[model samples]
Target: MITVITFNPSIDTLYKLETFEIGKVQRAGDVKKSAGGKGINVARVLNQLGHSPMCMGFVGGYNGLYIKDEIKKIGLRDEFIKIDGETRVCLNIIDKNKVSTEILESGPIVEENDMIKFERHLENILEETKILVASGSLPKGLPIDYYGLLGEICRIKNIKFILDTSGKYLESAINSHIYMIKPNIDELEALCKCNINNKEDAIKEAYKLLRYNIENICISMGKDGMILVNKDSIYEIKIPNIKIENTVGSGDSSIAGFAYGLLNDYSLKDCLRLSNACGMSNAMNIKTGFIDVNEIEKLFKEIEVLEYSKI
Candidate 1:
């Protein structure tokens, strides 16, 4: 079974407005809310694809309960650790032209005891989990090495670990030698400590991670698709261009797709194909990770994969 760990979960409130004026009273045309966080988004997409993923994370207070109810409404399984502090709410305001301005909260502070409870929850789930995905930011008061610790545990338990995060957490996870990592161009550049100007540069930087023991590396470049690098090979994959309704959670969806492919024993190329398709499909909807299987199937045929080798 697939298990996702979100250190910080939230209620994502999205608003649509004809125009956004800073420091002024503005009216929204439409509003929507949902359970959010990178790992939770992954679980939601995996569930849509007919896979039941158990979402594990810290949640508390009224907002936390709302998040849990929202997850259940979407038909996704969850096992959240109850904390004392209230959960956070993120705001996404989209203007008439589809330009999104996001305001993210720092989230509630997690006490040491809260962390312990979450670890215990994770420990119990790890026993039956085949794929363990740790994503998004760490909540306040939690150590930055949280993902790293989880990755190590997964390694010791022989579970396939997929990490999606940024900054120190991501760096720590890389050091732990997790099974796979999905970082966008910006995150990749930050991790590699160098500017990636082209595919050649990306491939060069990706090789550096291989020496660090990262089994598989996927660098997602938005519309340019993604580049996959492993010990044996490197490949470039592209998705057919499409109208993008929202880019949020595209990376999370891609991670879910890749994990799904790995779970189904798909080749790396096929895995990337599905990954790109899932991302593109998510882009066609306003909500994060909201996708249609029929759309994914149609887009799957349009993805192209090209293999590359060190020159």
Candidate 2:
């Protein structure tokens, strides 16, 4: 089973309006809400793609209950630890031109005792988990090393750990034995402390992190597709362009697709194709992490993977 860790989960409100003007009140004809955060998004996509993924993290207050209820409503298991602080709510505003703007909360402040309880809970879950995907930012009052601690647990237990986060948490956690990581250019730059000017630069930078024991590095480049870097081979995946409804959760969906392909023992080329397909499919979706199997199947055939010289 796949277990996803979201240190700071939330209810995501997406407003699609005709146009968003600063210092002006605008009306939105459509609005949607869902349980979100990178890990949870991964879990949702994993589940949609025929995988068993249970979500675990810290939650609190009425908003937290709503998050749990929403997860239940979707038929996924919720194993979140209850905390004292209220969970966060994030907003994404998109105009008719497809321009996206975000307003995110810092999330709850987790206490020391809460951390202990969560670790104990995660330990039990780890026993049944074949892979652990930890993503998102550290909540207030939680040390940056929190994700690293979980990575250590996965390392000790021999669980395949896939991490998608950035900044200090990612820096600290990369030192642990990680199976894979999905980083956009910004995240890749943050880890390597340099600019990713192009695909070759991304490949070079991704290799730098492999020294940290990270087996696979999936570099997402938005509309430009992605680059898959590992010790064995380097693959560049490109997705067929289509109308994009929302780019939110596309990266998480890509991670889920890649993990799913690995679980099925697909080849690197096929895995990269599947990952890009999932990401592109999510772009056509209104709700984050939602995808139709038919869309995925059709997209799988359209994705192109070009392998470069191995390292």
Candidate 3:
């Protein structure tokens, strides 16, 4: 079974308008809302791909209730621990030209007791989990090394832990025997504290992360495809150009695809191809974290994965 963790989940609200202006009253042409977090997005895509993923996190108050109901509506298992504070609401304002503006709220603080409860809950879940994917940022009142703690546990249990995050949180888990990490180019740059001018540079920077006991590193370059570096080989995946609708959850979708491929024992090349295909498919849809299975199947054959020589 695959388990997903969202340390800070939210209710994602999207507004579509003809155009957005400063200091003016505006009417939205369309609005959509759903349960959202990087982990939730990964689980949503995994479910659409015919996998049932268990989602674990914190939720409370009315908005948390809404998130619970929405997760039930989506047929995902809810193992969320109830907290005292309300879950956050994040907004995305999109205009006719496809530009996006975001206003995100920092989630509620978690108490020490609640943290203990979650750790106990996660421990039980890990017993049966084959792959564990943790995404998004840490909430208030949680230590910076929270993800690292989980990684260490997964390592002891011999479960593959795939992490998607940036900055210090990513740094915290660098030595925890992580199975994989999917970071976009900017996030990769931030983690490495260096500039990546091109694909070769990305590969070079990603290769350095291997010493941390991370087996696979996938660096996503929007529209330009991705570079995957591992101990054995490196792969450069190319995606066919297509009109994009929304790119919000593309990286999470890619992680889901890669996890699914690993579960099925697919080769690294095939895994990267499926990952990019899922990302591209998500970009073609208006809903975040959604993909058409038919589109994925059609795209799988079109993606190009070329092995890169070691630097």
Off by over 4 Å in 2: none
Summarize candidate 3's per-residue lDDT along 192-271 as a digit string, tens digits.
99998988788888899999989999889999998889998888888889999888999999999999898889988898
Ranking of all candidate structures by their lDDT, best first: 3, 2, 1
* Cα lDDT of model 2 by residue, 46-70, tens digit: 8898886889999999999999998
Report how far residue 180 has shifted in candidate 3, in Å. Answer: 0.9
What would the per-residue lDDT of candidate 1 be over residues 153-206, giving only the tens digit for each residue?
888999999999988889876778588888888999999899889988988898
lDDT of 2 at 275: 85
Model 1: runs farther than 4 Å from truth? none
lDDT of 3: 0.91
Give TM per candidate: 0.97, 0.97, 0.98
lDDT of each: 0.87, 0.88, 0.91
lDDT of 2 at 284: 97
